[model samples]
Target chain A: MRQPMTALERVHVTEVGPRDGLQNEERVLTTAEKVALVRALVAAGVKEFELTSFVSPRAVPALADAAELVAELKDVEGIHFSALVPNLRGAERALEAGIDSIVLFVSASQSHNAKNVNRSVKESLRDFEQIARALEGSPIELRGAIATTFGCPFEGNVDVRAVGNIARHFADIGVRYVSLGDTTGMATPPLVSERIWHLREVASGIEPTLHFHNTRGIGLANVMQGLALGVDRFESSIGGLGGCPFAPGASGNIASEDLVYLLTEMGIDTGIDLPRLIEAAHVATRLMGRPLPAQVSKAGPRLALSDCSAVPTARG
Target chain B: MRQPMTALERVHVTEVGPRDGLQNEERVLTTAEKVALVRALVAAGVKEFELTSFVSPRAVPALADAAELVAELKDVEGIHFSALVPNLRGAERALEAGIDSIVLFVSASQSHNAKNVNRSVKESLRDFEQIARALEGSPIELRGAIATTFGCPFEGNVDVRAVGNIARHFADIGVRYVSLGDTTGMATPPLVSERIWHLREVASGIEPTLHFHNTRGIGLANVMQGLALGVDRFESSIGGLGGCPFAPGASGNIASEDLVYLLTEMGIDTGIDLPRLIEAAHVATRLMGRPLPAQVSKAGPRLALSDCSAVPTARG
Candidate 1:
């Protein structure tokens, strides 16, 4: 007799909405508002949070108050607070701000790297190696991000082998975790699976993470495909912020609340409180003075009939 | 030795954006505009198009001109034009309108069905059986639609077995095709796959279709999972119109242009011209006096590097 289908595994969600989301918005959020949003998300049981970036204020003005925000959020507990860093300088700043982890970004596409970080893939690899060596023996865990892994707005379709090679390089440099970004939101299911499969093969032991954009509206689709490949870690923005600045018309990252809702509805234990997360999205949307691009913000939770019937409503 | 991973089979895309799309829009489109939109979609090579719904004008006023629109486009060759029907009356209207294929909808949740069609599931199923008998030995192909298959806004989570039983009933009544609708956008990937699999088992030989709402932002993710389960047909609204009236906070269906773009990118043959479909979306948006919720309309196509490099301007 054939074996019965096994129960699906629960996936871990790493929410980057606050950091990646706010950084790409036209309006800059106050430090207090950002902290409140973060607190709301924490109350929703989001353990992995990308708090902010420590890049130059000139490059990302929205995140210029990163240091102050991190300092103020020092009291928040039971969460993994991380920050994005460009080089050793940014890493040092994040470390000084008492962040638990730091993320380092490099592009899989050479052209995208040049346009996004003003560096080629080879040059970025070199910088990453230096940064990794400098951060050795620190309490902070290092994560390598490979942007535009699936497709690039500037370069078009990126080679799976190229992404695999980059993942291998990160592994070789002693980085335990790496994130593959669909920077321009060009990844679909097959491309997502193929790229993740190749990266897993090349990295051998390092765990792979996914960073998807809903630009073309396939962010969650890509996430499902990644899950099929046993990838549980993901990077999502709250209210879908942090769109591509270089690619015109590209929207922000995938919405964290949306992703969490998906995972939870699948019977996967994401440890997130759906209603509270939606409330957090509202807080972020108010800060932006407009609707943030989260689907769940407009559409409430997908509740079972029993749950809906139990809740008494004035409209009903 | 482990078997090498088999590549996923190609998925089919049914573009219902024109018919199902306009039916839910507040703006009523003229017959000429509707024909132009359909013609543009045909030029873009959409094979299966849900042309219009033949429901009563009093019930769905937005689709009041369905017959006139169908009569005008009778000359279009090599495309399958299907119509939505409420009961035998709607089916007769569709047949009179020269549409040979019809999609019949019934909600899986009793409360949703009563709210949507003003009837319970048992009443709707009895009506469907009568309609199926009437269409027997005719050229008309009846497609049974189970709305709120994933989750009911009024109900919460729907039982998979309940959906399967509904599908079995439709199959036994000689419905050739069945579509499970995530009316409130509550479907996660696992839920989609589980429901589709169970429905397939219950329906035996009948092929399953999917109608997804992008309300929770997991529309494409649900589509991806459905595709993985060997589902070929999908219902999408152009510019993502046609939000569920019964399901509070539910957004529109998935955008047809965006779905086509995703399928074509994955090397799946959708026979859809992305640019031309986008043009059709623009026409629809103009008629609606607001942007339809299409991601591809706002964001351009995902191109290869060679394609992007050849383009003169970076941003479309």
Candidate 2:
């Protein structure tokens, strides 16, 4: 029953259900439900949790209580609770709430930046200078997330060099981990691989993690190539929840349970309790009053065929 | 827009919706609709198709028109239409119907065979002996499929050596191509890799194709590993149709359209037109009177980004 019993190499997972997933969902979970999920995730052996986002309530109402949520989980033991900050004000709120880690966002595509944050990519980087200076004396660990790094819906085929420049900006500010978000779930394996390679070549000091969506049904395949390329970290959402707030019925992130199944079966340690994580997904479904698109939650785990000697294949 | 524009590998896809998909669904299409699907598939550039199963109508009402369906498509030029044969009688019917390719099934796990066919594994092997002798020089290309080769839903954790033994048995019967069926969708990449290695070590002359179910959400991931293992042939259902007849509500085969998306993007030549394949999936949902769980069908094939100068990250 040990986590990573087979997966010898450790694979770090950042659970983003509370932030990325809930933000895109029409259902706004109460602070208590959100807290319950984050607590359950930590209990399920998650080491890192993107606990909340400190964006303006006007922008992402589901995460309106981001500061309060951060304050509540900031002291949770055995996990790194982090917050997503859209700008300097969000960063201030997260830092003031005593959060130890923060993830900043910038889109690799210029049009995405304008549409997503109402700023050009260059304008956001200029704003980053102020945000970076504000975090200079803060104890927070900063990470940069470049959304639409794989393929931008608006721009299409985002230039890999654009992603590197964003990574360079983060590296310049002493951020050690930068995530490439497949925001629209348009990432293919080759696209993911090429981006990671280009990022590594440019930001040799940063650790690259792939955030995938099962929107096109190859999220795990994209992760497989990422794993093959030696990516040690990934970001996924519980229950495969979330889609663009504007795009209803589109899938969110790769389900954490499905990702764990892939990693654990490959003898790569995720160190997460898969069944417990699935239980959390079930709870989310009950809370959301609908089934989220997490497949392992429905199919059960690889049949764990070891416990059976008597044939159940008749009704199976 | 050319296939194999970069991924030079030539991959063969067998569309199995009319057989594998329909058999597991509650709805049964009429003979004309079945013929229409076959014709549309042929028009969509499907060179190989599993059109029907020759089992008794009583056992599977979904495929009661097996004879008619096979006869309708058997002589379609530019396509090799095949049927599933459950026993000696089934094979006789298929051969008489002029279907030149037949897929014979047996379970690697004893209990699955018993539950699936009410026969023991050894008994099926004996049955194979008679079926093989009957098909000798009978204008048929015989391919053996070892179901539950990865894991058995009833028995769970089916021995890989047991699978190698089954492959060896097929090879002994003059069957040159054998497929390893993830009957319950329990395959992981490492298990797939190890099994392929073991199967090759034991049955060197036989070519292996991977049949995957996306029940646990890694169907395409499993296929990616199979491709990396150099398995060039695959069997998939359009709209991700077909589940184990016994495992209701469980996902059936991986969607052929989704598989084509992966291959075409990787620059591999599937020869099947991607858009046309998707249209066929749409036809399936329309005929089934419900949406099939095909992701790319919902996501719209990577946005083609060709029209983008300004990123349209808004609804994307």
Candidate 3:
């Protein structure tokens, strides 16, 4: 059997808690609190962030202050900030905010696309084209996010060809960074390998980002599969902030601190400080006013030793 | 890269919820409740179980009724039941209860062994000799469990030679099944591969079972590592019942439903029913009167569809 990739490989961890994690939450955080969360992560050596989405305030009240949150942290140095954009208007607003990148999303499953964005997959792709045209000569980069790329909640087992077709559209528009979203936490190891294989064939030269949710509790397992396939980019939420509205109690995204801890222990560098990242997760938990789903934050790192006297003498 | 093991490979999932799970809980279940949990899993096609442990009632108050629980579950046909035994006396009790196997445990780290069972590692191994003599002509099989096989809380980073020497001792005593217990959730992918290699060199023909905790939320990830190495047998708890007493919010064993779901999705045959196992997890949750750490039971399976109409219109 082949050994795992050595410590020489660096993995990029994109923190998406402010955008993807907060959107599904019932409690809306203030712009200041969101800035605090982002600032805490930035101090933890986090370089990339999916900050917030420039969508209608009426649609996602939780992220109503997206632009305000962006402007609050505008002076943070050396950090790449990306925001979700639904159309040309959102893209233009992101440009005015001086965001690093604008990610245009369309679900691979048509039914989910219609339900989520109220547009067919083709219409969403068309909107992306308009956004791309608006940024033709701009310094900002264009990225594509294909939601429900693994499996659709409404339509189960999305075809790999659907993902490949969407990737082809993104690549055609000069979008090199495309993220495959497991919108409902339906991603499996085999499906991850299959999609990566399909992307290599159908959308060559486009870098793929694997964004997985831990709703089914195998999100990190899927990450291992991605690593084994030599795919390095990953996206996660701090403190596992998001919970799926449809599934009632299901987890949303894999926790950023937990992901960083896993990468660090595997000798894969993510350029993030694990202990400081855990403190950021604690900040998110405190602001959320509840315990987040993250384990490492609660458990501490593997070597965070306890006083032998502190442990109760019991059957282990 | 080599592909994952195919569907032709069968993995053995040993349900250890009744034994390792309950032993750590503060709330004690009635013997009938214990029997019910085992029967529910048996109905779910789980063939092997670490049903309970025959230890001193004073030492483990929660599992005080281990013998009674075993006797209640004796008539369950076609199921292989094992129990943890501390010494010759406990092993004799397990034999009277007609258990198929008795697992002898010692910590790879001497400090942990002393802290846990109030004995030296050498003393524990000597006790195993008496237990082996008690079962010399008996039909019951002997299995070995090495706690803190990856790392120790009191002594960080246990040497692989310690684990190898223990496995060698177990093999010398006519034991073929040896479980390397990640007692404190310190097993990483590299450590797992390293220890497995060590065991292969020293212990030779013993079948190794990988027991991991989700303390830092990477239990299933370790399982993927094990699968890639062609090791099939795994041990997990129902509903992730056990939590580390030392680490307040740390999860103990990986949830059985989540483990089985990952295996099934990977096209590996476990011969375990997913939905029924989930129902059993629900029973455990209800009995605990609090939510268990298992995610699959709460999220449902991947294909479990919701009425598209019931889904609230929200930003993805």
Candidate 4:
């Protein structure tokens, strides 16, 4: 039987649209438009955000105004904002931005790491060590993410130990929240269960956050497995804003509205307003000038009724 | 924890592309093109199909050649073919075409039933009694479907007992297979479990075939709940080829390739050739002259590795 909603009543959702979603889009929103987007979601009661990334503007031109966007949003009350940082330089910039947290990332697959950052996995880990040392005793919290934790585009299947090693590294540095990224949407139920169990064995104190993409159309299904395992934290984008730069026509992040719909329908509490989230999704689609891949926004809330006389009827 | 794959290994998937999928489309397919589509799915190891509807051509012109399609596919070995029929006349046509079964449908909601067939639910059930009597002692199987089994478009939430009553009627008429149709994509995981449990108590002998739409993006998540409840049979369409004419912009059916991918990844057996299924999805898209909503077909298989030199890499 499926897990009763009583077992896991509350879940934490981190909206990643501003950073992970927009980073791959060709159309770049101005800093003000980005601020407006965040405000819309904040009105929907979204308090946790992967606000932006402190990567080189030359590398990801879509998010070139990351610091400017953060500066505009840093004073929002009762919100937890975390920014992705690649190295010591990015980490230092994030700390100076006065955000709530800094997320240091490394790819679990060596080939993906090299392709992503032009460095080997060993070098990335060494850089993370320096970044962790730099953030020591800072008020801003430190977290870690392992990309390509499920599968790699350049390589076929990533080893479990590769992900475990990164989690172990994060645990060693006193970081507690570790995110497993399905960078190319290769994560599945068995792989998710296996990885969570492996992390329990290797780094028992670390709380795993599942970040899945709807690339293969099983993103929410994977979330079901995560919920069944009692894992609650997840990451999604508004209107499913991101697509994989490596895999053309592949979706990047699961849509935030759809994720909330799934959790809310299951009777789980996320402290987010669904109608407001859907309203935010419309703002996102208007910002992009196209329909997004998120289904819930297009379909409306489950109870949004239709007029019988207005719709054509079919026999089958 | 998630159910292990070993417990309920083999799941049966019924392809409903020919009838339920195309009936809503504006473009009418020639009998040959329909035949080609069925052949493509057959090549992908699909053994069960809701092949066509024996409805009036004036009502649904897209599937006007129902008898012709059944005549074309009746000779295929080891295939189970079923057709949707609204009244005694359609049932007679389906029986004449030598189909394995005939599906009789009625909307669980009164307004939907009135809109769909211009009859009340009671009148529809009385009509089913006549059809059942007409097919008495015949070799063809009788199956029943209740549309709007989850939430009705006009009405908000459907009572579980309303669904149970329909199932009870189906079981009373010697119908062992009853399909719960999420006609407008109103199904959620909790609704699925509740309805299934209610059916078990009200109509214990009848097995449910879940027919879900991807309108809200949790179609596969609902399948996960069905699988958890040990319900093995499901229905999907190739390329997700249908849309609800009643609910504009909402998707009609879950894509077959995506469903098979989820099952295969979870190590559950659906006896499907995924690559071949993907090939069929491409054929479906070509036939429609547009991109469909299926994600896996657009994303490719999980192991379809990318060339490092040809693709762009992102830091996040």
lDDT of 2: 0.79
lDDT of 1 by residue, A1-316 (tens): 1111224456678888767677666778888888888888888788988888888787777788988998898887788988878777888888888899888887788877776667778887888898888888988888888877877766677788888888888888888888887766777777877776677677876788888888888888778777767787888887776665544444678888888887776667777888988888888877778766787876666663322221111011
TM-score of each: 0.89, 0.93, 0.96, 0.96
Q: For residues A1-316, what per-residue lDDT tens digits would candidate 4 score against the true structure?
A: 2335438999999999998888877789999999999999999999899988888787878777877888898668999999888888888888887878888888899888887887888898888888878888889899999998889988889999999988998898888998899888888888999899999999997999999988888999899988888998999999998886555556669999999999998989999999999999999999988778898898789898754222224453
lDDT of each: 0.75, 0.79, 0.87, 0.86
- DockQ metric, candidate 1: 0.33
Give a tens-digit lDDT track for model 3, residues B1-316. 2245453379999999988888878788899888888888988999999988787787778878877887887678889999888778788888998889999988999998888778898899898888788789999999999999999988998999999999999999999999999987888888899899888899997999999999889999999888877788999999998886666667889999999999998888899999999999988987778788899998889898753222224343
What is the Cα-based lDDT of residue B56 in candidate 3?
A: 76
**What is the Å distance of residue B180 in model 3 from its true position?**
0.7
Docking class of 2: acceptable
Q: Kindly report which residue stretches of model 1 are placed more than 4 angstroms away from their true locations once superposed.
A: A1-8, A244-250, A304-316, B1-10, B133-137, B159-162, B244-250, B304-316
Give the clash count for model 4: 0
TM-score of candidate 3 versus the correct structure, residues matched by position: 0.96
Task: Tell me how many clashing residue pairs each candidate has.
Answer: 14, 12, 0, 0
lDDT of 2 by residue, A116-203 (tens): 7888888888877888898898798888888888888887778889999999888888888988888887888778778877888898
Winning model by DockQ: 4
* Segments of candidate 4 deviating more than 4 angstroms: A1-3, A245-249, A307-316, B1-6, B245-249, B307-316
Off by over 4 Å in 2: A1-8, A244-249, A304-316, B1-8, B244-249, B304-316
Fraction of the reference Cα-Cα interface contacts (below 8 Å) that each candidate reproduces = 0.35, 0.34, 0.48, 0.52
Q: How many backbone clashes does candidate 1 have?
A: 14
Model 3 misplacement above 4 A: A1-8, A246-248, A307-316, B1-8, B307-316
